[model samples]
Target: MKKVTWKIQYDSTPLIHRHCKKCGKKTRFKSSDQFRINAQRQYLDIWLIYKCTKCNTTWNATIFSRISPQALTSEQLNQFQENDQALAKNYAFDFDLLRKNGAEYELPAFSIVGDDIGTGESAEVKLISEYILPIKVSTLLRKKLHLSQKSFRELVENGRIKDASGQNLLKSKLNGETTIIFLP
Candidate 1:
């Protein structure tokens, strides 16, 4: 985690206007800091926090909300339960698929993976997640660890590669499996 510091002006809630004493200018604020409520704070985030663009003023702000961290309305709780149930079912199905399939998987292209999937390109990447060496990183290990890719797969399937780092990475990849993709 990094340190973060914020410099802001103390202004009224729903900060609307600011008066520049020097210029005798009053202009409407373009946007509200409330929009940044979703941001995560770092340890010393000095400049990352909001600052006034017009007068370079700093402001403190506040908002009111009744919901506690654990306070989920019945409707929200039900929706969350339903979502969790659906996720569990889907995860079970995928787990079974992965169990039968071995490492290497395919998923739609989006975000970090947007460059990888969702096209006429075939989705059949290699399944390396469940196998000892994570499929996505297997090729790299093949060179660095001086391990044969074929032999590595055979070793992993046979319960051989038992190092702590290897095991953890394999586990994480299986949990957050990336779609197997072909470079060519």
Candidate 2:
């Protein structure tokens, strides 16, 4: 087995530069890739994050560190900002549901709690609290967001996915071209 060697090439800043064997160019350590990093640990969550500035060839590196606020330097602060943006994309805001006939339902015949609602379409959607709508309506969220039959079913089978909101993937109504009449 070949012996491993590491050189501490950091200058005045908390940064280091390394010369890559694949591309004989010097690469600087990105600040984001430097936090919570354990150079010796190669876990799946541990990003092997060595990169060449010139060639942009990203590999991995391990460093020892713990999760703490002080560990969150200016560099890590930037990474946090990037992480927050990614977390926000998974959900959408509430949309009011109205029937296709321009009429609305004032009361649900009965309340549905902890039960499967409508199918892929035709489900009623409402804002939180008093803004609730009894209208047989849906957010039309399905068309905008879809799992592409294969992936959707796969997710269901894996059990890693579940619909706790009791939504049906089958029921349907409304098309993409439905005209929108804003409530006054």
Candidate 3:
């Protein structure tokens, strides 16, 4: 049988949090799906709003500043006007917006799901992180694969599982193309 290998890639999952000026502490925020728009003569100002999880304080992340109506497509404008939840979820991961507003963020948690059986005695797996943020590979692997500490250590000792780059996967932050070989 051909060796079963997985070329894994994932999108950036941002840990969205903001400091609550009212509560005087860092708090998780949820997308409000609410927009505040203002018409300044011919230009329009738009914001994507978020509310603090604890206190319900509002934070406005600027989507556009003085943008002409002609600049937006009808669909795009309608999405903003209607407060699309899907669009809001995408916006929730906007690190640029969070950084612009001087808000604090954490690394997002991620997991991988796959079938139990691989094609051969060994399989090549690639882990890709779309986010600019670094992820802890060892912990993620342990959690995702449901492996015990002893089993993981044994694999490491026997060199049955190793990074394709020959670097230590345990200490490194997983990003870009990280290839791992799993021995059955």
Task: RMSD for all candidates, in order, please.
Answer: 20.6, 23.1, 4.8
Candidate 3, which ten residues in sequence have the lowest lDDT sum? 1-10
- Write model 2 residue lDDT over 1-184, tens digit each, in one string: 1111111121221223555566766555332333223333432222224345566665443322334545557655455345432211111001131132122222222222222332332232321222232232232222223436565455445543333354443332332122211111
Q: lDDT of candidate 2?
A: 0.32
List, residue by residue over 8-71, the lDDT tens digit for candidate 1. 1112212234454544666433222221122234211111112344765543222212334245
Between candidates 2 and 3, name the one with more favorable lDDT. Answer: 3
lDDT of 1: 0.33
Error of 1 at 7 (Å): 47
Off by over 4 Å in 3: 1-16, 108-111, 117-120, 124-139, 146-184
Q: What TM-score, to 2 decimals, does candidate 3 have? A: 0.64
Model 3, 129-154: lDDT tens digits are 44433455666566656788787777
**CA lDDT of each prediction against the hidden true structure:** 0.33, 0.32, 0.69
- What TM-score fits each model? 0.19, 0.20, 0.64
Comparing 1 and 3 by TM-score, which wins? Answer: 3
Global Cα lDDT for candidate 3? 0.69
List the candidate 1 regions with Cα displacement exceeding 4 Å: 1-70, 79-172, 181-184
